[model samples]
Target: MVARTTDTPVGRVKPCRLIGLEQHHDERGSLSIVESEWTTGFPIRRIYYLHNTRTGTARGAHAHRALEQLFVAAHGSFTVKVDDGHRQRAYRLDDPGTGLYVGPMVWRDITDFSDDSVCLVLASEHYDETDYYRDYAAFLEDVRRQP
Candidate 1:
């Protein structure tokens, strides 16, 4: 199916997919950690989180040039969508122990956030404003130029 970037539920997108982390259980609750280059595939050099997002709002409507990110929902839930020019996918992040790995060249947008949601992001590179493609049309052009 041809994937069109739309706010409506009429597109077919491919999910970057979620990676389930190993959870250690105990009476005190649970613990989990991600190893860089092993489970994460990239060494995390930066960390950030998003919270207090109002309902019906969205975030991350762009793509990175070379940055890779792993997104985890530490609390509540949100829907993440990604487009690769040829295809698109949406992933629902709700489990804290699970992570969504987003690679470069993929246009992404995060929407449908719950009030109590806490989204944690582990990035492979340091912050670089020049690495971001903030325009959707530009992102598509970049993707199309890729082999």
Candidate 2:
């Protein structure tokens, strides 16, 4: 059944998405490709990679006000947890040919990184401190205020 406003937090907001990429191989090697506005559904303005995360560690425990991101596991595997104030979802990223698309106003974090994991993030905007909601309560309040 579909969840309603009284049952779900951020009731009117769009949920995150999992997207597949194209993989081309011809015995030489393999290439995985993703394009902004095509696969990501958002234009990218910034790019970064995360690595060397110690075991049992986590990062990115915050939400953006108006930024979108696509995460690709270019090397190994990791888990991403997303919270929309009223609900939560988890995704395992283990393939370079796949990506998880996270929209704004959603809290997300990365954990369970394999020893060789390399996570690449393509962002829709540049960094801005005002665009971030680092506190869970504040994020919830903000999400509820949206129309």
Candidate 3:
């Protein structure tokens, strides 16, 4: 779980933290599974993956208004830096059995991709352009307006 560093709250959204998925290892190899009940308690509506990212490149410089997402490093590793307009934290994802759960209204910037990195993302909502806050200032404004 992510340790709270600020007394100032960010509405009902929980802070981003590392979630360990169910893993089984055998002579055949290993397998990881993420059940609905074992995740952020939201039904996954979209799933995607990022691969072949150029060197020194980054992605996800935005925040969702209502979308919750889980990110797992299916191969290699990368860094996910999240900001809640109050506190900021960086988590390194290097294990396939572990994931990072990002709640709504939190800004995310994913970077530091390895050569063979593959980032798998499971989202709670389908594609919606309007649901995203691509501007940091706008995201912070909306977060401040929350009651």
Candidate 4:
């Protein structure tokens, strides 16, 4: 999600938001479509999925400096916690037709995976270790310095 940077007195737009995909259902099954040109604000450069995650285990304890991603629950359920230096929020993902969009500079922590869970990820960029902010304190400090 691309957040609005302007101050609103009430609250600033969050850097992470939920996006719903169009789903078609019938006796045959269900189908959901995601088009990069119309859905994701950024072009899709990579696609991946996480599965067989041990119960009680967690993932994603870092923030990206330039990458943007969308996460979907392709099988079961999990929790995604996001922080933007000043604010924090948690989202539960169980529906395959919905995805959580995480923008740059936002910290993400994924946890509480169910036994059959499969997490799908769509990224705007290729794998780059230099783009990752693995330390939370450093991520916070850097984001706070931004205008």
Please tell me which predicted candidate would have the highest lDDT against the true structure: 3
Please identify which of the two predictions, 1 or 3, would achieve the higher TM-score against the true structure.
Answer: 3
The lDDT per prediction is 0.81, 0.83, 0.86, 0.83
Q: For candidate 3, write residues 1-147 as lDDT tens digits.
A: 232344444325876767889899999999999986456578988999999998899999999998999999999999988888877777889999999989999999999999999999999999999999999999899887877
Pairs of residues at least 3 apart in sequence or in different chains that clash in candidate 2: none
Instruction: At residue 89, give the lDDT of candidate 3.
Output: 74
Rank the candidate models, highest TM-score first: 3, 4, 2, 1
Q: Which pairs of residues collide in candidate 4?
A: none
Q: What tens digits encode model 2's per-residue C-alpha lDDT throughout 1-147?
A: 111223233313556777889889898999999887888888888999999989998999999988899989999999988888767777889989889888888998888899999999999999899999999898989887867
Off by over 4 Å in 2: 1-12
TM-score of each candidate?
Answer: 0.87, 0.89, 0.90, 0.90
lDDT of 4 at 73: 92
Candidate 1's displacement at residue 80, Å, is 0.5
TM-score of predicted model 2? 0.89
Model 1: what TM-score? Answer: 0.87
Backbone clash numbers for all candidates listed = 4, 0, 0, 0
